[model samples]
Target: MSLARENRIDLVRGLSLLVIFVDHSNLSFSGALQHSRGFCDAAELFVMMAGMSAALAYHPASGAAGFRATASRTLRRSFKLYWIHLLMLAAVVAAVFLLPFIRDPALVREWSLDKLAAQPVRYAVEAIFLRYLPAELDILPLYMLLIAAVPLFFAAIDVAPRLALAASVALWLLAGIFHLNLVDFSQPKGLWYFNPFSWQLVFVCGLLAGLRVRQGQAPFAFSKPLFILAFVFCLVAIPADLVIHLGEYGETTPLRFLISKTSEGPLRLINALAIVYVVFNLDALQRLSPTGWLRPVFAAGRNSLPIFVLGEILSDIVTVSVFGREGIPLALELLAVFVGVAILLGFALHRDRAKRRRSGKPASSLLVASQPEPDYGPETTTEPPSIPDARPNTAT
Candidate 1:
């Protein structure tokens, strides 16, 4: 893909991360930004981006060196992701404890640390094992596990691209049918909020799509009728989300349990793919310019790992300290957005500067110097792209 096209992917990733932050906080604008009004949310987009990025970085390695390099890079990234998750977990737990002393005590008893305080050692052990994640923190653990499984996914893809996808789908279906899921140490019977078994299907689809992107073809070649159907389904979701009467119809209702992020229900996966199909088919990136007003978002996407973690921490703080109180001013919400973007931009600048100092070159050159560049020369068919074997090195 062209650099311009990749920038657009970063734009979507950044925007998704931003919206996820808003959704985490109880800000009013969250309703406008949150895709949960439909069947998917920022989590779907984030995971999809991660999978595609991984494939783009590692799938084309040619020999023993490439294979070992890819494996080492992936392992390093998994380690970083796990460490970051632990740090964030500690921060979140601290926030849960600290917020009450500074704000309304009644507001956080359920959402914060009451139960955690009851059994600190057990919960700590669970968090370490990634079996006791709370709401916002759940996604991190899933990403860590998924990163660890990158090698297996690549092995499957090597055998046959379709085989990888088929395996992913089978796992998802079996998980749903047998209720195969990870148990939370905090609650022995509690299932993982974002079940990796099911969500892997979405990631696998993205990985396959990335392979097609390298070959200069669309991932899923849906017919015209299928594309139209997908469009109509997305449109219907807008109203379906607004209508509350559907819930009153009970569990048997067609829409009641149609999709679930927790189990990554089939319908939900279909809905997310439908959106991706439309976006890819239409050259959606053409509409978005990296140098345009959306540059901040693009930067955030480029540095999604730190930005997402920071955004979550900030959003949660706002949720307990500001949103939990009555009548939150619009200015405050807008200020929150500004602050988040500023932090992301500032971090980007710092990273760029530090990279330049290490490389002794222009900051832009250093930005991705660590990554192997993709080789698309005359020997492309025989030699793998030489570009960095490491993905973005960030768990989006």
Candidate 2:
């Protein structure tokens, strides 16, 4: 197999992040893609890809010394995410208070910044602990928690891979069965919107897949019957959710509650895994040439952290300004999304240029090829199975 770094992962990740921003914006006609309409969405894509990326980057460090190296990197990244979350929260707080003073009072009520202002001290502390997430702010803390625990996953896999996976599944089932989850300080009755206990199962699933890939094997066994079953499930799930409105039955259907997003329901996991299977086996999105038109997407994926933060900020702006407002056509809201993506692309380009400058590279090599990545896949005669410890893809 070719050892080149997988551009498809980056490409899919970038698109997923953008899709998330649009989905959160509540703009008209923006729900055409993945999310809400089904059991899966960008978040699933993000977490799974993160797991794969982590395995690719760290699995070689599976033994004693290597484990330390992987743990150190994981810890450094976890801290970085913590700091980044704090900065983003601070910015959101600033926006919450500043927007109304500078522009419109409606924003204060509209964005729900008043409560935060009312108890800044308490909320600030709570926010630090990820107990005061407003909206569009929940995913990062979950990601941070997962990243911190990745070394544990590596250890578990080293001991007995199947047993590790079973443990993850058991935790998810227990969380669902007992309604166990992280509590929200802001709303004591409510739980963390993206329950980490449930979500970790998905992350672990990805970890296993990535480990298998690293070992020069298909992530899952090729089972025609299994593929057909997953395929039928997807076929039925989409129309059930979108057309028949089956998800609405959750309130009435006792068993349906287990499929809820809050608990990271079992159906959601199945749907996401099915989608992932289709994507990997079909090479559905892997066909893009590195130098093709979608290179900006690769760039965005490469710089996902900054792009995600920027997208969240922009989504807030759209929520208050365009969504639910009269005289604002769907096209205009879509235009705003287009503009938001363009800005992200520009930011990525600027960062690329800066890195080149820092390296004292001449102008000729400034435009680095987005492809030609160091291979982290399974072995081949031409190259080693493992890639060197390069700058880690730190985004989740």
Best by lDDT: 2
> What's the residue-level lDDT of 331 in candidate 2?
77
lDDT of 1 by residue, 198-287 (tens): 888878887777666655555568589988999998888656644522343313445444555566766667778887777666655646
Tell me each candidate's TM-score.
0.81, 0.83
Task: Go through the candidates in order and give each one's C-alpha lDDT.
Answer: 0.62, 0.64
Q: List runs of model 2 lying over 4 Å from the truth.
A: 30-37, 60-62, 101-114, 244-247, 323-327, 352-396
Q: What is candidate 2's CA lDDT for residue 253?
A: 58
Cα lDDT for residue 66, candidate 2: 70
Candidate 2, residues 230-279, lDDT tens digits: the string is 77887777766554232345444553564566666667778889877766
Show pairs that collide, candidate 1. 371-388, 372-387, 372-388, 373-387, 373-388, 374-387, 375-385, 375-386
Candidate 1 lDDT score at position 96: 62
